[model samples]
Target: MEQASRTVRGQGMSSIKEVVSSWSDVARLLRGGDSGALVPVVIPRDNRGLRWTTLVWFGLWALISGFMLLRGAWGPIAMVVAILSFILAALWWWRSSIVEIEEGTVGVLTKFGAISGPGLAPGRHYLWHPWARVAYVVDVTTEIPYAAPVLSSPTHENVPLKSIEFFLRFRIVDAIRFVQTIGAGNFDLVLSNSVQDAIRQRSRQVRTERAYDLRGSDVKDMQELLNRQLTRYGVQIMGCNIPDVQLPDQYREHLATRERVAKELVAYEKEWELTRKRRIDTLLMEIERSKKIRDAKIVEVKASLNKARKDVAQMLEERETEAQAIRYEIETQARTNLVAAQGEAKAQEQLATAYRDNRAVLGYELARRRLDVGANLAENAPRPVIVHTDAGSADNSALSTLLMAQLLPQIQAGAASRSRPALRQQPQPTGDEVAQAAGSAAQRAVQAVRGRQK
Candidate 1:
């Protein structure tokens, strides 16, 4: 039994050694690989887990120290425990001096009631509470707005502008100067005063009507001027705005009345213009219609005139044809008359030539004329006159001669009568010659009959 107890004790001692070695490894890791040295660190107040750990450690230490005191253990171990508790309490109090500056914020540090350095940046920083202090934690990134109502004369002509609400946005650029001059608590008041002063100074140069027109430019000018005033105190003006403006009641009413009258006049002019344009359009349409009618009439008249001219031309052509026919007929008739006259003249000339060339034929023609005259006389007178010829006288020369002698005196007397200028002075035949010729012709006829009877 003694040997078995010895082996079990040895096994328990080995397990205890293993446990102690694991704890030493953990402690070394926490001390940054040096078991005998402590790693310096800064603790952030905003770390909730570290804050809780510190609270729990303080509670545990107080409880342990109270328990030791209650047991009346006033020995070296009690003193050691008290000393450790005091040190932990001191560390916990020191942690309270640690300041955590978030991003975009600046921590203004002051030592012995004066600015110590430039400033503290973002992250955890140690500042002793009594000796060294964080005077201000300024939010340099956030823009602060300041607004106020102002009253001023816009035109410097006694016309006051009221209830003009102006706004200014600004931020702290130099935290040290901000804390030294204006401080965080009075930042809004200082910015508001600067904005009001700038607006008042700029407003006096513009009229109320021009103010509205130059609102944007006015705001920008106000921002620049405000920055000039606030820059010395570390306040930078970001922007300025005029959000609202109001005119006096009387002025507003007057403007409304004028606008209403102007609109009525404009409407009247538009109606008059429309009526005039309508009349002009109607006149143009009438003119177009008249022009079309005139053009049609002109075309009709032109056609009639053309037809009349054509008819006149045709009638003239027909008249010319008739005249030509008449002229041709007259020419033909003239030529026929000329030919007939030429033939008649030629026949008369031939007859005169034959009469002049042959005397025997003339004598024979004269004898025939005398015989016809004597026959007519015998038929009219109381006695008959005849001439006889012998049968043996085959050439009737003697009879011919007797007839010529008997007709010559009568022919001569006729010729003389035609030649005389006056018919009353013409020579006449004697009655004796006429009786003798009759007697001779009768005796010859008696003898010829007697001879024939024997």
Candidate 2:
């Protein structure tokens, strides 16, 4: 019953409403949902200048008001007309100047070739134009999808890579160049084709191995190169992304086999290395054993030779000792005889020298006696003493007299020395009383000298 009621309600609507509902239903089907409230209107096939025509009508009224106000209308009327004219001009200019640039940005301008902006920040903007017409408004900022089609090479044994779609988020850097080169009417086609060309060129230049390598650095390099190449066509490849890489079923099998073969080869090489090492070890052991045998034989021969050498050395040493003893005896006898000869010769030489130096000997004896006298005086005398000992004093009176005279001079010198005050040896006494005592002693000495003379 609910289904029937809904059916009646749907049928009760006017033809127009039903038509709109049907359109909504179609939209819901496309969106994969149920339509609730939506009206559909027929879109004009020739959507050329419908909006422009409407703007023109409104602008024409304002232009007429502006002319009337300038011809001396009332003050309020003139102001209103002027305001209306300006608004209409602004509106027409905005509509004309507006353009859909790359990335959904709009551009505005005036009729005198002056760019009216605030350039479109995405959606819509209104402005005025005097003489200029908006040339081309294009969506220069749009993601251009690029695909590099690379079929697998059958001849190559290396891994095969499949076709890949590369997404490039791009914005038109140069609007003028984009419209001129990319043809405003067929921009999408041109953009897609250009992107495709660049991708193919770059992909072809790089080897298949590098692409499948999945190296981050390699992908970045390719993206940058693609951007730079496309920049000349006013297409900025903002980002190039590799979302998927499709591989053939057969390629998967081949890859698996290659991996298996690689693992097997590694194992086989490892075993071969082990075998080689064993062989090398065995050879080394044999060489070592051979060296040991050779060394043993050499050691035995060396021992025998060493024993024989010891015997020979002992015999040689005994012979050498006997020879050394005989030589020592001969040398000792010869030295003893030579010493005896030298002693005799020395005795003769001494006799001849004694005879020849008799006068010098006598003079030396006299000097020695003088020296003894001086020595005796030095030993016995507490103070200085003179010694005038003469060598010929026993028989010569004049010599004796001369010696006595010398002694007398010495005695006088000693007395004079004794009379002098020994200031260095004594401490000075203090006060006049000590000085008086010193004077009295001096007077007594003088008196004694006088008494002796008498």
Candidate 3:
């Protein structure tokens, strides 16, 4: 409030000091400057026409009192009157002439009881003490808290509501109108009345059971309404709301009962949905199990069918092998019989041919038979001991003759023994006779063979 403010050329005046600084401003302010720099409210206690008169009177009064005190007045009443006049002039100078406004507070100035041009900014200012004065000081910056708790308001159905507590915060927007139109002392009544009226209108819009909707709901409409109604009075509603509401006891109990029923209905719906899902799942599982059983049975049947086919094929193969073996055995037996019969026929033909040729070869056959008999007879006779020697060795020949001589006796003994066997066989032939008989027989066989050759 003590800061010096800038004064520009065309911006006009911002302080009371500038308003009364010049002769023209002082003249205009004396003519009831109700059009500028102060609240528009009129006081009508002081007059603008007596602007010079009041100033001259104020100056004269102070001078006279000072002169009287300096001259040392003798009368007691005169001294007291002069002292009071000075005191009055001082009080007028301090309270009316000087305007000292604090920060956040707007100052309203009255020029001879008429509001000046506009609200005064925060700062100290000097004005015509006897004519202009600061009327009201208002804090325009801070918000004011207010509440209106209504009792027994009716709803749209005319259902009686218990209570509705309304809360808000407000601040001043127009300092001049706020202080002049509605002072701070009576503002609370106006605000409370407006709040009650708004609450009633809101309650009438909702049903009794839904009155709780008023609480904890965005109340922009209500707040806007209050702002419109109270705007002229310079009050700006910042935030307004219904913080609490109450219903009748019986209505509260009924709402609780309805809530419980609704909750039970929701629970039953969920349970039914779960049971249906479970039933579907169980049916699907049964179908799957049946499908698996059918597949297993089919596999078993196919396996058995394959086994039967394999067994049949094996039996057929065994029968075929046995048939082949029997055919082979039969063929082998027939071939053996055929071979044996053919051999016997060939042998008989050869034997008959040999008999037919036997008479033609009779002599040769007889000689061969005689030679064979003689060879057998010689082989059966006792062997003589003969000496072997080289032809050129006479001594060896002599020794051999001697050995022969010695062996002649033993040989004669062997011949005697042989003759005894011959005597027993009815006469043993002499050697020369045996030789002559064999020769005669050979000569006859030769003649017979030569005749046949011719």
Top candidate when judged by lDDT against the true structure: 3
By TM-score, the best candidate is: 1
How high is the lDDT of residue 398 in model 2?
81
TM-score of each: 0.43, 0.35, 0.41
Q: Put down candidate 1 lDDT per residue, 179-208, tens digits, no spaces.
A: 677654355446545655776776777676
Q: Which stretches of candidate 3 lie over 4 Å from their true place?
A: 1-98, 263-454
In candidate 1, stretches whose alpha carbon ends up further than 4 angstroms from where it belongs are 1-73, 128-130, 152-154, 185-187, 214-218, 262-454
Please give the distance, in angstroms, between residue 258's alpha carbon in candidate 1 and its true position after superposition. Answer: 2.8
Error of 1 at 80 (Å): 2.1
For 293-360, candidate 2 gives per-residue lDDT tens digits of 99999999999999899999999999999999999999888876666556545545554554445445
Q: Rank by TM-score, descending?
A: 1, 3, 2
CA shift of 93, model 2, Å: 12
lDDT by residue for model 3 (1-454), tens: 2132212211222211112232223323323333443222222222223334454466566566656666565444455555666566566555545555666666678777778868778787777545666666555765655667777789999988878888887878897887678765456557767887898999999998788898988889989999999899988999988889988888878977887898898899889989998999999999999999999999999999999999999999999999999999998777666654555454444444443444445555567667766865775566666656678866755666887778777866777678556546654344455445555554555455444433
Worst 10-residue lDDT window for candidate 3 reads: 9-18
Candidate lDDT (C-alpha), each: 0.59, 0.51, 0.66
